[model samples]
Target: MMEIQGIDLSIIWSIIIAFGIMMYVILDGFDLGLGILFPFISDAQERDVMMNTVAPVWDGNETWIVFGAAAMYGAFPLAYSLIFEALYLPLIFVLAGLILRGVAFEFRFKATAEKRHIWDKAFIGGSVLATFFQGVALGTYVSGIPVVDRQFAGGAFDWLAPFPLFCGIGLLLTYALLGSTWLLIKTEGMLESRMRHYSRPLAYLLAWVIVITCGWTAYLQQDIAQRWLHGSHWMLTCAVVVLAVIALYGLQRSLRLRHSHKPFVATLGLVFLGYAGLVISIWPNIVPPSVDLWQAASPTTSQLFALIGTLFILPVILMYTLWGYHVFRGKVQVGDAYH
Candidate 1:
């Protein structure tokens, strides 16, 4: 265990927690987004291809969520309590959707064509519900978590506000971009070509929505703009912009060259850069201006206890994820082949 200005070893654990959450969002988020875009494929064969694109990896991908939640519960008990209490309904909905989707995922394989159609719809619905609510939860945090004496003072619908709603839409488009990129990488021929064509237009639209949403957010909370533009945090905004430009250009070139790998890799980089910008821009504030990291964290002893297990488990998870992807890294097939 190391110390930073005599801060507890738990701070490292907090970093791990943050890392897990962001990683989960970027990894599992694309698959969920792909699942969300399932309905748009129109053709059942293409839909099956999309489904197979993520089937092998989706369940494993969700492990990060567990890691993140456990880390938060152990290292930041206050934050865990506050978020769960405040966002109980949304969390419940997210969990329900995830469970339904997971079940529907397997059921779709066993069910007949008609029953499979129902399960497919269920999976898509579940994915959308979970994805949208996750966005709403983030939006609530951005807008600020209502607090009174370290407890939630807001209603259940507090997260469904206008700014949060826009953020939700932003998240939707963001995921759609992710889905398109995944399709570009995982499929070939006509489907891959279609995904490639769809990606740029979707990315452009998502970029527009994101810019407008950020502007709207700044308008709503003047401090966000003030901090983003004139404060010490301006560098993050520049970084995000530069990365976005690079990602866009790379995506354009990838489409032209029909590169299977470039677009997904570039999009992943863009997502990480954007997520990192958000994290840095809002550091030391777990629940924004009201709650600082240290104040939200668990006791040092409790954190040390959690660290023991995380240290053992984290590397295993990392190794397995890398190995799984390495094993499955190739063109996904449609029709009666196993994924």
Candidate 2:
């Protein structure tokens, strides 16, 4: 109920934070997916082209993660603290993977045969570690972080579970689909053809993973199930499912037709729809079972202060980001530099 200028800052920050999360998932998700798919491509030149595709925009893509975390800490201190505490181990590893991958990006481009190969491995491993942990964290969050007396009461490794593992695999597949579709948009000839060949399989895999994860979450979490099983919310859930299925179908068709942009758009739509459904299912809840968004929100003053900067700077960031993409649009080739 905290208000600022007649508007609820809690809801404002929540929307802003959700937007940041979605952007991070879409932007950084593709590059990390490309990194995960790196090792599978035997040709060194192919890897170079893949790296080049993301090079101009990769650093910018990752900025949203930092923004999201910091904003949550400022706007929803309790939820941020509890979620981070519950995910301490996984968060540490996620940071480490991101760092390792950043370093590998530099070294792999500069080193000779042997050292480059080693760095390449590092790049793949790092991306896998980061993306997997992110997915695990998502699953753990959805399952609910243990809370006692309004504070985190879970063990460090509480998130280490079969459901989280399955989620990790599912997220990895989803990201790979995004990456492959992006490659289709940013590549041509042999690499693009290879991506087209791979897109159908990745799409199918992602579709199943989404279904399984949705079923598991619904079955295990009563509130979430109820959200889907009753009321008009069920219609919303059905719409999301239908939307995802349509996107997948469209993606496959786009790949077949060699539509450079449609596959990427379709894949992004699936991710967006899935994300939207999850948010809808857990609307008021921040950390789950009982920690509703209002309960987890920070003071109105804090949110208002944060919004001053966010409201001003976010649009600027968005503008520049779009401009950068426009400048870098078109196919990326093997000889292009990482920058």
Using lDDT as the measure, the top candidate is 2
Q: Assess each prediction's global lDDT (C-alpha) against the native.
A: 0.80, 0.89
Candidate 2 regions off by >4 Å? none
lDDT of 1 by residue, 11-112 (tens): 687689888988798888888888778877778788888888877789999999998998888888888898888778877888988998998888888788
Lowest summed lDDT across 10 adjacent residues in model 1 is found at 1-10
Error of 2 at 43 (Å): 1.1
Error of 1 at 14 (Å): 2.9
